[model samples]
Target: MKVLVYWAAVVVALALVAAAGGGQVAMAAVRCSPAELSSCASAITTASPPSRLCCRKLREQKPCLCNYLKNPTLGKFVNTPNARKVAAACRTPFPKC
Candidate 1:
């Protein structure tokens, strides 16, 4: 569990870096890895409020959200009502995708 959360945080971070839009430099730094969103899994899967870490990662990964939503493997999870609640709790806007 800890390991998963750790990986998820990393993913969100990468997405954040990419969204930062530093041009090529930023793109290189961006990861957009879905694994990084692991930290939010528990909150999104359960009724628990999102943790600070989860919220932070959600913010960081905000740019990659649309891609995640478009992904067949991950779209379902990202589109869930629970996921929306988690996003709301974290103050991260849910992607239109």
Candidate 2:
């Protein structure tokens, strides 16, 4: 019983670490201003990949993805594959929004 409990605790801890490192929480830090969004929108729409400014905004808005994901309307934009591509181009990992 003791061994089983200890293993369960370890498993839970590891799972938490993996989830956090997967960028779900880190994405909360990555948002853009309206001006920044305007500029970023073109690139995002064109699928040209994100620029440095876009990447900065992405990191800034990172924290918001989970919330955005929870919203049906906003989730479409936040959860797109293009967004993930932009993130990759920017060297920012795609958060599991």
Could you say which candidate leads in TM-score?
Answer: 1
Worst 10 residues of 1 by lDDT: 20-29
Instruction: Count steric clashes of candidate 2.
Output: 13
* Candidate 1 lDDT by residue in tens digits, 7-59: 46645654664465421132335656665677777777666898898898888
lDDT of each: 0.70, 0.55
Give the winner by lDDT: 1
lDDT of 1 at 84: 92
**TM-score for all models, in order of appearance:** 0.69, 0.56
Model 1: residues with Cα > 4 Å off, grouped in runs: 1-29
Q: Per-residue lDDT of 5-24 in model 2, one digit per residue for the tens?
A: 55355445434533554323
lDDT of model 1 at position 77:
67
